[model samples]
Target: MRKVSTWEVLFVPLFFLLILYPILAILGNITLEGMVRTFNDPIFWDAVKNTLVTAFFAALLSVLMALGFAYFYIFHPGTIIYRIADFMNDLPIALPHTVAGLALLLAFGRNMFGFAGPTGLAFTLLAVVLAMFFVSYPLAARTIASSAEEIDREMISVARTLGDSPPQAYRRVVIPLLGEAIFSGFVLGFSRSISEFAAVIMFGGNVPGMTQVLASYVFTKVEEGEVSMAVTASAFCILISLLLVLFLRLEGKLHARSEKSA
Candidate 1:
């Protein structure tokens, strides 16, 4: 065994503390009373329900879109459509949340689509889900595309040659190889949607029993000077994010184990 240098021992801890200590400290300060109060609050329950529902639907939609986009990119890498899709996928990451919200609002707001048309979508729960899906789909699609690029197209072609239909070849040959990455993308999209704030608030309009989510609710509480309530909600978001991250990590480990056994 060699003696560890002071710098080596301190480096990792310093980075973690710098990045995470404030959040941990804030969470630590929330009393059991604050937690219990939040739990019993109807608003809290409503927010929780809306958050979960939006995240679930948004993740599902995002993953589906990601799958289609990734497939197109993989199979038609040189096409103008693929190039355009790649450029659009890079937009969400580069865009400011408020700017994205405004752009979405402008496109979907009432009278823009048509007065008395399907414009109810602009300031409703559906808008929240749509915003979340758009924000997260690019992330999922990019991850899937990157993984798809690494796979051997020859195996898929061989499956096609051996009487496998396109769908069957994809299911048997491609999906299994890309399963871990796909699952990772799904979790990432879900987690990202759950924590969305500015876009969700702008698009969903914070209708308490309808569209209010954890982040927006927390912001509302903070604005009203309900510090404890805001802190409690923030803590809840942190907890959910941590849980999702743990699940994704466990999933990665399981996928690695399965691959090793194979």
Candidate 2:
């Protein structure tokens, strides 16, 4: 067995204290009564539905946009447009989420789209989706771009030599090879979207059965001094996040096995 280093010993306890302990505390606080009450609450169920629906759309949009960006970055790395996009893609990561939400609110709160209704999109479910997408897009874009960078250029060249056009080559060759990366990017975006609070609450508002999601629901409970309910809701969110992580891990192992078999 390898000997544990001093750094490992020093960091391990810190990791447990800072990260693992909080998760344990949340889970530990869950009571059967609270769980039942949370489960039976119609508002909780509505939040679950809203959260799942918005998160799905947000993640899907992020991945679709990321695919286009990744393709450009991989195939046209020398272009100024690619450079601009590359720089802008990381903006979401650097921006404070509340600031991002405020920006979205300013941009979309009014009738920015011209044809939109008087209220535009703010304080609506669509606003929640946009907020989630704004915060999560960077994760999807970076994940896909990094994976695309690892792809063999020779494969594209060979496909081109075989009379495949660039788009055709991308669709037939690159996309098929990026199955794992695409799934990972989607999951990462979904996970980020689901946990978003500041942005979602700012842009979407905390209106139950409409824009309220699990994160905002928990916040609402906390504001109401319903600690038991908040903890229960938090535990539910953790369970969902944990399931997504486990699903990703399982997918990764299966992808590895398939690669080995091939």
| Model 2 TM-score relative to the real fold | 0.95
Per-candidate clashes come to 0, 0
Q: Report the C-alpha lDDT of model 1 over 88-182, residue by residue, as the tens digit.
A: 99999899988888788888887476564566468788889988987999888988888988889899799989999877887788778887778
lDDT value, residue 118 of candidate 1: 68
lDDT of each: 0.85, 0.92
TM-score of each predicted structure versus truth: 0.91, 0.95
lDDT of 2 by residue, 1-262 (tens): 9999999999999999999999999999888888888888999999999999999999999999999998898789899989998999889888899999999888998748435766678989999999999999889999998999899999999999999999999999999988889999999999999999999998899999888999999999999988788999999999999999999999999988998999
Query: Candidate 2: lDDT over CA atoms?
Result: 0.92
Task: Indicate which candidate wins on lDDT.
Answer: 2
Residue 174's lDDT in candidate 1:
79
RMSD of each: 2.3, 1.7
Candidate 1: clashing pairs of residues = none
